[model samples]
Target: MAGSLPPLLLVGCGQMGGAMLAGWLADGLAPSVILDRHRDDIPAPHSVVRQASDLPDDFAPALIILATKPQKAAEILPSIAHFARHAPILSVMAGKTVGGLTAALAEAGTPGATVIRAMPNTPSAVGQGMTVCFAPPTATEADRALCTRLLSAVGDVAWVADEAQMDAVTAVSGSGPAYVFLLAELMEQAGIAQGLPADLARRIARRTVSGAGALMEQSGIDAAELRRRVTSPGGTTQQALEVLMAPQAWPATMEQAIAAATRRARELAS
Candidate 1:
């Protein structure tokens, strides 16, 4: 890896990519080149080109990010293969494994390209995202460190040794936000069922969930401990937990949901 990340070459500027680009800019990284067919609202100091050919002949980036959809990877990869000669490719696309990326580059005649796979959620937009990354054995320590810096710009980062674990990562954090959102939705509806006004229920549910999450983040306590702290010996919360933690209730259902998502992630990779 380079001592410092040089100018970045971002291949896509969709919602996720735009969030990261925004975080990087806010963190003072500038002089980046974005290659995308669709126009995106990007801050200044970062240039955007409609296509790879539009890039200046002399432009070389220290890092190249693959943020396009997995289905379009083959179509988008070739244009950026030139950057892989010097810069490492960091992919935020889900279900695309390291070998898959290497193969894509190989198909583009750039087998020497080093790639890292990252799974980051939408929360990255707020700089509080959880991003998990994996690098193949060929990636150098500096390469990993460079990726850590890049991911850390948006949020906390964790690394896994096994590439196969990425499927679980996808099921967990990758799709986890929607699960939380679903909880908020159900909570709001439940409040309404309990005779609360719809608008009040919605606001209360949203704030309660958000506040609990913030507390969990800052409290330096595990979720189980936090739950224990909140649930009295025989209180209403404990009563609710009895129902939610029932064998066929939330615990089992959540497990099944995550397992289904994990399977789908593997399916997409294949």
Candidate 2:
């Protein structure tokens, strides 16, 4: 029980929530309550309910996780404000700021509630997530540590003091997995176009992407250095890199993409 996560009240069980839940379950979580409409197959020691109203009256979770869609925050925050009085609220809703969520909870009768914000991607489902968190001044060191403990059960964890940076974090890491998957997709398509069999193309493309990621992590090498290692002068890899790394190619496109995503995140918060 020493290493186990404390009891939690998870407000949603959609893609992101479900992914974190899977990691917590695999590690060791205390008896928790999941408030979700579409989920039903949790094992013993945990319970699932369709709505917050159905939560057990005597149950008191150590932390309340608000993983609902950002659009539903206004509707969901008030319902869970009572719980916030007893426990810090950890919100995983995209584009929802700590101040905004805290204001909503206050309007619902719980003022000065400690609210922490986190951006976690879908890779959490595989226990390889990258979660970035931001906590307000009201949150205690213990609150931050609790969040790190719970989130790290899934993958790596980092924190930022400036809440404004969360928008860029959202653009880079929160939406980063899709970018990687897109790379794999393009590689597979290119392989097929080059006369490789479809099945082999898919397999090699996926493995190459995953393997490269693993190598980067395990070797702790700079990605540019790794690229240099792979790209011999005028070789096939160099030829491809030359095209991909052109001024108007991936470099510029990626910058524009992340800028667009960051702007959108800011817009959502507003």
Candidate 3:
């Protein structure tokens, strides 16, 4: 276990929040006081409360993590602002900007709260996640370090100086996993179409995608270089690459997809 994490107050335990909690537990973080309207999914041993008003009067958390759904932020922020006054706020809700969070906290009576925005992928459940965060000027070095340590439990942590870059971050790592999954799904369907048994197609597609990703990571090689090494001048791999890399194909489509996601993120923040 890394040194004990500051006393933590977690505001939600759904999908992404639950993944981060699982990672924290795996890393030996002490149980946190969790606040959620629905408590069935919360694991045993960590204290759970249904409402902020139910918290003991003397309770104080050193870090408060906001993981509620973006739509729920308006309703939940007021309940947590007491904790926000004394602790740095780490938020993983998609499209909730730091300025917006700060304003919510202020409305709850904790003015100028130090708010940090983070975007983490679903892979965090398996300890292979990518997390990018942007902190306001009010956040101190210690505050940033604490946030990094918390995020590192699930996977890698990156800090961006410009909060505006967060929209791009959301489009990339935050939504990248779904794109990879779609590729795997399409590959399996293609294999089945080519006369392979359904089970065999599924197994091969999953293994090939996972193995290639692992190899790329372990070898520290660029993806394009790795792809090149596998393609011979007249090989099947080269033929497939030529089709996929056409001007109107994957390269162009991927850029358009990311742009669409980035625009949605900006719209949500507004």
Q: Provide the clashing-pair count of each candidate structure.
A: 0, 0, 0
The candidate that wins on TM-score is: 2
Candidate 1's residue-wise lDDT over 1-270, tens digit each?
Answer: 222335888888887788787677767774789987786566676789998788776787878998888888888888778779888999988898899889989889898799999998888878888999999999999999988988898899999999999999999998899999999999999999999999999999999999999999998799999999999888999999999999999989999999999999898898
Off by over 4 Å in 1: 1-5
Model 2, residue 263: what's the lDDT? 94
Q: Give the winner by lDDT.
A: 2
Model 2 whole-model lDDT (C-alpha atoms): 0.93
Which 10-residue span in candidate 2 carries the lowest summed lDDT?
A: 1-10
Q: Looking at candidate 3, what is the lDDT of residue 206?
A: 94
| Candidate 2 regions with alpha-carbon error over 4 angstroms | 1-3
Candidate 2: residue 50 lDDT (0-100): 96
Native-to-model Cα distance after best TM-score fit, residue 106 in candidate 2, in Å: 0.5
Candidate 1: C-alpha lDDT: 0.87
Could you tell me the lDDT of residue 14 within candidate 2?
Answer: 94
Q: Write the per-residue lDDT of candidate 3 for residues 39-110, one digit (tens) a residue.
A: 666555567888888866566777888888888999888877888878899999878999898988898899
True-vs-predicted CA distance for residue 206, candidate 1, Å? 1.0
177, model 3: CA deviation in Å? Answer: 0.8
Candidate 2 C-alpha lDDT tens digits along 65-149: 9998888888887777999999999998878999899889999999999999999998998899999999999899999999999
How many pairs in model 3 have backbone atoms within 3 A of each other, for residues 3 or more apart or on separate chains, i.e. clashes? 0
lDDT of model 1 at position 3:
21
TM-score of 2: 0.98
Ranking by lDDT: 2, 1, 3
